[model samples]
Target: MAYCGNIRQEGCGKLERREKYRLFLYVLLIGSITALFICWMILIWEKIPGAIHIRAGIRQDLDLNVPVSGKLYKAPAETEDGAIPVTGMNAAVDAREAKTLSVDLAEPLTLYAEDIETYTMDLKLFGLIPFKTVNVQVINDKTLIPAGIPIGIYVKTEGILVIATGDFTGDDGQAKEPVGHLLKEGDYILKVNGREVEGKAAFMRQIEESNGEELVLTILREDQEFDLKVRPERNQDGEYKLGIWIRDNAQGVGTLTYLDENNSFGALGHGINDMDTATLMNLKNGSLYTTEIVSITKGENGTPGELTGVIDYKESNKMGTIEANTVEGIFGELNESAASHITTQAMPIGLKQEVDLGPAQILCSVGGAPQLYDVKITSVHLDHDNINRGIELQITDKTLLETTGGIVQGMSGSPIIQDGKLIGAVTHVLVQDPTRGFGIFIENMLIQ
Candidate 1:
């Protein structure tokens, strides 16, 4: 009986030891998972920025405000032997001692002036581990007159653009597709029969004079030039047709964003796209003219409004010449006649980082004269994929809401001001909520 009791006691002791070993393994696994999760959170909280833009002549501090402790070291090429003073928290003994840190911008930014455009820097985690390389852009700040008055824009394309292709009836009363698969939308008709076609009128004249003869066409598609042979089809009305729709120029009305010290102005927060093809118009030569708003179509849910204006194309009404029609906006120098109208004082521009979510104002000309209206910036994306949508805002001013039904077509280039600084310009209005709209950063427009 004693021996049996000893065996039972020994088996129970063994079982207890085995249970404790299993518990130890479980605890070890749980501890590892928790450690990994904590590390991931730390990394995310200290997410490094891709780039930072600083004004050349400002005494500001670089406030990344990241959670993890780090030291910002300027790149070697940017400094003398890369021995610039370190700006950050002291090295932490452990992860538990980590804390947020910032760099003193006065030293680095002051070194940049008219000569240096940009440089790079390295951020070290815990003052040890390499975190990321950040691009530092140095820009000169400018005071601009935020002009919200309407202007007439006229832009001619580099070549006759083929907006679409269609089938036409020949003189024999049979359907003909002379441009079948030979030309597509967005194609530029550069020349006809080895002669350069200057404008839409000249191109159409060539087509009409083709007399149903096979014409050798030089086309420019996606930067590649090629030749195609197409015969004109005579319609039932005896007019020769190329079975394609083409456009050479576009005209519209938009609000002016600002006028720089050089009298150069930017307008149309977005590019001028073709009505049918929806492609950016390849600008050849264009002009900006004076216009007067004739009517306003108030915006509604899912339906965008517009501002109709009377554009006098006379030389006396020419405001400026359009030098560029870019995706960012249109840029050109305002003539003396137009620049003389800027009676308002210039305001400093606000960088993307300086923009905050709060009360803001927009300068617009809905009532014939430019005026300031209240607004609210709901969101600001510091590093957004779409540069034009970095700032999202809503119309809060009752006066603007009643006048334009919250943001209409011609209000796109209206300047958004916050804290007495020009921060951005209205770019697009939400189709579902006309009261809300997106804006492009003023820094983006200045770069362009």
Candidate 2:
């Protein structure tokens, strides 16, 4: 009986030992998973921006919202003088530990150079672990005269633009699609039967003279040129036509943004898209004319209004010659005589990084004369894909909101000033909310 009792006791002890061992294995597995999860979170938290830019003679504070303490050190850069640290930007300390890194770039109180200079710095977490390496760019500031006066823009397309292809009633009293798949909207007809087309009038004459003959049409679509064969159809009125609508030129009225010391100017804040195709017009040549505001149309929800202006297309009313039409705006040289008549004061331009989210002013000519109106910058998106929409603003001036019912169509390119500096220009107004709009940074226009 004693031996049996001993055997039972041994079995019970072995079972107890096995259970404890299983519990130990479970605890070990749980601890390993928790440690890995914490490490992953730390890595995600450390993904901070790697570079920053600042203009010379301006003070800015940069904050890196890392939870732990970190220190900044001057990183060596390879320049013409070899690996060295640039002292142009002054900071409080070369190395210091802090919970949330904030860099106060207040040194070099004056303009440093006429060109852009780059510097580098290194950030370390807890003065030990690697953080981020930052590249600091300091550029020379520029000054420009913000010109908000109204102007008329006219541009001749590179070639005869095809607006649309349609079927026409033929002389046989039947519908005829002469164009077929030969051409489409937004395509530019460069040549007809080996002859370069100059204007719509010349193109119409060529088609009429074809007399139902198959003609070779050279088409330009999206930077590619191709040839197509099509025969003109005779309408019931005995008129020969290609069954296509075409345009050769476009015109509109818009505000001028700025004038540089050299009389160079940028206007319209955005490109002129075709009304039918909505594509950027290919510019062959264009001109700017002086405009007289005749009347105003108040904007309402879901419908944008415009400024009615009378532009005399005469040599005496020529303001400038437009050289390029781009997504940023139109660039050209102001007529010397017209430049002398501008009475606006030149102000220093503010870089995109310097723009703040607060009160600002926009110079626009609602009446016959240009005037400054109050606005508020609601948002600023740095590194935006659409450069023209870097800043979003809301009209706050009661007089402006009452006069035009917010930003109108012709108000584009109105200069947006903040802190007495030229920051940006109005580019687009929200159709759903005319009181709000988007702007392009002045630096973008200047770079173009």
Error of 1 at 372 (Å): 0.3
Q: Report the poorest 10 consecutive residues by lDDT, candidate 2.
A: 104-113
Model 2, position 218: C-alpha lDDT score: 93
lDDT of each: 0.81, 0.80
Total colliding residue pairs, candidate 2? 0
Q: Residue-wise lDDT of candidate 1 within 1-448, one digit each (tens)?
A: 9999999999999999999999999999999999997797465433344666677656444454453333344444454432222233332223342222244322222222333355555555554666556766777778999999989999999889999998978788999888899999999988888988899999999889888899999998888999999998889899999899999999999999999889999997888889998988888999999889989999999999888989989999999999998888999899988999977789999977788889999998875789999999998776666767889999999988998889898888999999999999999999888899999998888777
RMSD of each: 8.0, 9.1
RMSD of 2: 9.1
Query: Residue 15 deviation, candidate 2, in Å?
Result: 30
Per-residue lDDT of 234-274 in model 2, one digit per residue for the tens?
A: 99999999899999999999999999999999998888889
> Candidate 2 at 69: error in angstroms?
15
True lDDT of residue 117, candidate 1:
50
